[model samples]
Target: METTSPHYRHTKIIATLGPATQTRERLTALTLAGVDLFRLNMAHGSVQWVAEIVALIREISAEVEREVAVMIDVKGPEIRTGDLPEPVVLTPGDQIHLFTTNATAPAPTDVLSVSVNYPDLPSDVAVGSTILVDSGLMRLKVLNKDATSVRCQVMTAGTLGSRRHINLPGVEVNLPSLTEKDEADLIAGIDAGIDFVALSFVRKADDIFALRKFLDDRGSPARIIAKIEEQSGVRNMDEIIRAADAIMVARGDLGIEIDYHCLPLVQTQLVQACQDQGKPVIIATHLLESMIQSPIPTRAEISDVSNAVREQADAVMLSGETTTGAYPLESVEVLKNIIQSIEPSVSSDLNSRIKLIEPKEKMLRSTARLAQDLGDSGIVVFTRSGFLAYVLGALRPRGVPIFAFTDNESIFRQLLLPWGVEPFLIDFSADPEETIQDAFERLKEKGWCVPGSWLVVITNALANDKVIDTTQIRQVE
Candidate 1:
């Protein structure tokens, strides 16, 4: 399979892990198919299950001799209907009482009432408010309320399943950023040595700050990826982009919570915002959704993916398409094909979009320009923390491959999430010139370059007994 050929894919791919794709063979197949990261959605499995899957993924990565990162997406501050003894069918104008489990249940078990996971629903919602159950499949209008319960008339009818997600459109409910279960799952993921933690429903910068503090308290080196799926998150986008290490335009609930028509604009805006700040942003949810059933994706879905690639998002994610879909491998192949086809057509003048404020930022912008000037050039960097490589990836140096070398295995895995970065793990030498020559030899050995290939090597090496950044060009030998 040639490992899906990373040459044409500047935009990375992230796939969710599920029962359909949980086996070691399936994981290996997806990794070789160009999956840069595997998302562990905490919404589906238990903590123990997540730890075991992480171990399996690590094993698969070692066997394949490739770097694949694992991200644990925390189920944060979700509102859902409680379990039902039987499926409840509702029609227009049918009324039901909704209460928290802490509140007293109605006398009869057959009553047309349900318990919500959030206790604040009664106080948070008001009369004439529209509440969407199960991603707006059924609509409920709050007609009346009391201390512990809110009486609602079902405006739209559907079968209400247990633990169905509840959405209060145009109403903001107060909930802690990290639910009890979220904290537990995060702890397990951190202990399992996950590369990234994606916090869901990030409404404000404080949400990211709190999660960062949580990870910091435990000395977890994992970075935070803020999910912008709520209007509040969009409203507070500037701060959230600054607070979180990376951002994800989670279009699922954002489409339900806000006007679906505006989702495209919001996605581009979020991606641009994250890029302007040099943060890697992911455009997630339904990139190739039709492939879930059919092997071929719809034209509309392909266009959606092209838009994300054209916008230069760090990655496009697969949810059900790779998790529970019938065509997991095809989904990845389709995405990779779409990305490679469109990326070549799009202009790589994104260097103008970014404001080079920091000295290193300005330097990397010049690096990209210089690479363009050199023609047939590649940027080689050595970083223990992967910071220089991340910034260079953000610069979107089209046609110039950035080969990042790191001694830290964790950083090697973490670097896979960034665009345009191909991470290589190698042991560094005590001598600076020796290490640079070693990088050159590795580039040649891996067929990244030939004898006459020009390489741009960037590193912070000891010079005159003090470490300083250096950039120089060398021909592969």
Candidate 2:
């Protein structure tokens, strides 16, 4: 069961590492503050940095004796402006001809233009097309095109910094899901034994399939988390959800790529879609973003966090707030506090939301209901492959915290993302009864249960060389 001691919160928290949490001391502090996992954003750090930080986190996790998972977010197929010696200022009606990286500047017209990182930009867009720079802050309307350039008139005024993100709404991106740099970063992450991989700006299920195939060939057991940020991704949500091991609502680009007014509706739809498919979905980007500077979060931010919690997201993530923020620890606590405050007010049934297609899942749902019937009972599951634990978590049983005991270290770390699952790594004996007792001993040592605390245990018993499924309610001595 999830007690306040080892692990308990229903909504998990993920924090990014940066200058603020680079050292071992700060990393340990954040872990103790209730960060279940750490995200390494490949966009900002180098491959060498990824190896070093994963080692550092492992060292800290060993010292703290907690299973904290690590995830790598690959910068997948992003469109950004080319490096500029200085910021380019664009005002309304300003004409700029964006040229390919190797193309020569069009015959020195009164037009101001900058080189684009993607050479295909000239071919992908057409006249009257709109291109957004710097997260939609600056808008450009295509006026004309050539083999080497696309001349455009500015629709919105803004400054464009070097490598600023570019978004083409309603346009399909013709880029590989995993860039060369992304592959290199993924290799580093795989070597470092990361538990999860997040593919940024995932446009379709094939993107997930491509990354999955790459990982499978390398024998990497890391699960894939597809980040839906573009319009194409929204249109192909069902297939993406089916292909991905998990989903992330990447609101930063999503808000810009789609109608801002309908972003909330889209968010709700994404969350529901994940729930319906029994996949873990994360709500990310700009959550408590202001807390990066101020210790206090705006009320609106609190409400936003509250809404995600109410929607029953598997996890909530902090981007700049943890990596570059002044108040990293406070940011973690704020998210934890909000999750704690909101969970009690909302109730949802996983059985109704997700179809129980598997027999194990249906039985697991029944076990959850049984635990609720027995007051003050917690569900205990001893899983070898972590399948039982994951299925039970996807069932979204309320009031009963799932104490998943796995002998496999990798499974223990991988289970950190599911809702209400507190995974523990312990050795399993040949005798199933001894294994059950060992799990009980752990619960007693942690003070999670008293002399008479009830536990609903699900395990397979080895009898006559045959494994027999068993579900029983036992009282602690």
Candidate 3:
């Protein structure tokens, strides 16, 4: 479609832009090496930084003539420790006080204590609750509490630095999904025309609905990606998945909230659920942890990526590996290489794994199976909203290339994230048959339609259905 070639591998790559890959040269290299989306983590950057980076990415997209999607990941209602002069080191049985007040620092005490940003932290956490800091790098158990402070015993000791995250397992912290800071970020991101917004620490569908309402109010078309990293999020996975445009299995904080052994199962379930719904799912966090320093990834890291591919995850993401890593370019290259190597085996059989849950899915699956059965045939799908394109892409039929035609630019960009669907930005015509004929002419011009090469033409206009209406198999003249 559009003369530009599709990636050899169907699975997309999302790279985080940070200190390492923030420059134009590094980002250009990553874009050329097949990074489909760039995630700007709001937890770290200021508004000025985000605006500048978004401008640079848009400039790069214009130069490359590719629609590079930008995602601004907002920091939701999450708690973090305040600034400390030095890292606090504690051993077993050491008492640490977590104060919930403006006075972040205690008066130079030998005993360890730090102030948290949330004033209601002590009220929410019980004496027996467990507190994890910096994704379980340091562990503490609540031993006592008062009106403004919660004193804890250091169960697992590590260096506790300034502005570290705080996690209370089995404790429900009543906070609004969107904080004031998140609203500011979202407004700025929408003004900058970000393609996606990832909401962090999402606990239920309501969180996603609130963000959606905000976006709709501003008439912004930026899609919402729910970051699932909490136990409540895991429990409400179905509602969250249905509510959000996409999902990211954020394992960094998830490992701290849930048992370590359960992370894999949760990841698998999330990926499978997203696949079943035809929504994109990203496997993120510590995928190539070692590559942050070393030039190469560990064997387990390779297998981890490979496993996501085998599971038919729509995409895999690089967090720290492409952010502050010394080997950012190497990490992207290695991830690309691994996907290229393992794609052929898994992509061809991806349709079999998808359960046909809905009528649209059933029709789409049958269309894909037909195209695969008829060797040397190509598929041309005309979608107005891009829903049908995503459905077919999720099915992942063998050997058949899908040529998707849509007029909407947002749909064109969203189509890039899905697998097997090569999207083209074309004008919409009132006559469905005329549009089909025009699309075929373009395909024939590109030699995609050759002698004895049958083609399957699919569209949603023939039936009364709103999502997807029709699939017709035809032989090329």
Candidate 4:
């Protein structure tokens, strides 16, 4: 499949960088194969490693002449089991002890025991609470607990490994939203000039607010992407979406927190909520896990990516599939192929899923309708903040491309997160008319618009030093 040109597909691809795809050659291949953004996971990398990856991404981005975004995924307050001597096999009827510790304790031979990094796990969890480990591959039911220890009975049997993630569904663990490690990483990421920072294990709007405050205090403009991976986050998704600049459907921990069968419904709801609010939503984790080992993806994985596109998710992410996969380039190609195949149908059937949340949305909707009615014209959006472009993309105007021109580079990268919105960075012009004319000329030169073609142009008209939403129909000369 021809995967080099992804301009036909508006849904972006976010690929993780790790051992397999860390080299310049492999990263370049991923960029050419339609990876719009690269994610660096702080969970497994050091500050120096992240800096190197950021540098590599910029180098490749310059080489490709595409402003590929870089997102630093901070490991937030996550509960993880302490080290284990070896993988312990648990049976359905076995009892285990979980305690809190800072350092790796001696191997426990007396009982099947483990420790968590969170010291309040025993105090937070109660009897009858469920404990999931290793992304819910192993499960345990809490039978007893104290300040020092939590006794659990094995409900699901599996081999438990060391330093695996621990989840307590329905139990609120008293841990700070930002760990000390995360703060250090955040500083490093800001210094590296990352475009976005994804806060892992986000459970409330306050989490986003706190991170926003941190960024604001430092005068850093990196956008925050709230990762919804907990039950509390799902329940309070409305406020979280309002607070976050973007969202990531972190289905790995989310599947562990909620019923596995309900994931599909939850994903759809999250995607819809984001679209309604004009926030970019990314569906992540296990999109193509089979590609990690094999050269080709399974049929089911292909459908999973397609469904996310149909749901109008701004992007579908590849975690381990591209990070540690042997066929990282092939994974990117396969994902692009799937999106390119499904996006046409999605665009043809696109409808107004966005609720008129604000008064500006109503006008945006009307403008989109006008573009659709004209049928032969595309939409040109001139913005300094990219807000108008985001609103139009959320409206999902079928059969019309939104060419957004912005003076801000950050906004241009952020614009790529929306569906059907292609952002171009141009010099800022004080006169709105001049900006529109320049944009029209550039669009014509790029073959997106032609002479004598009609276009619906949207911008904030300047008059009396006040800006207002203005949509004008013009014929390109």
Q: In TM-score terms, which candidate is top?
A: 2
Q: Per-residue alpha-carbon lDDT of model 1 for 42-151, expressed as tens digits?
A: 99879999889999998888888776899999988889998889888899988888888678756334448788888889899989898999988999999888878888
Model 3: per-residue Cα lDDT over 410-451, one tens digit each: 888777777667777778787887788778777667666754
Question: TM-scores across all candidates?
Answer: 0.95, 0.96, 0.90, 0.92
TM-score of 3: 0.90
* Model 2 lDDT per residue over 1-477, tens place: 233233356788999889898798899999878789899999898999999999999998989887699999998887787777898788998888788877975544677667777878878898998999899999999998888888889999998778888899988978899999999999999999999999998889999999999999999999999999989999999999999989999999999999999998999999999888888899999999999899989999999999998888889999999899999999998998888778867774544778777677788888988887785678999987777887787777766788999988888998999888888899999888898899999988877787788899998876798987778899988
Model 2 misplacement above 4 A? 1-7, 102-107, 462-465
Computed on alpha carbons, the lDDT of every model, listed in order, comes to: 0.86, 0.87, 0.82, 0.84
Model 4 lDDT per residue over 239-350, tens place: 9999998999999989889999999999999998997677889999999999889999888998999899888788889999877888888888888888777876764544
Query: What is residue 344's positional error in candidate 3, in angstroms?
Result: 2.3
The TM-score obtained by model 1 is 0.95
Q: Candidate 4 has which clashing residue pairs, if any?
A: none
Ranking by TM-score: 2, 1, 4, 3
Note the residue pairs that clash in candidate 1. none
Candidate 1: regions farther than 4 A off? 1-6, 104-111, 461-467
In candidate 1, residue 256 scores what lDDT?
Answer: 94
Clashing pairs in 2: none
**Model 1 poorest 10 in a row by lDDT:** 1-10
Cα shift from native, residue 189, model 2 (Å): 1.0
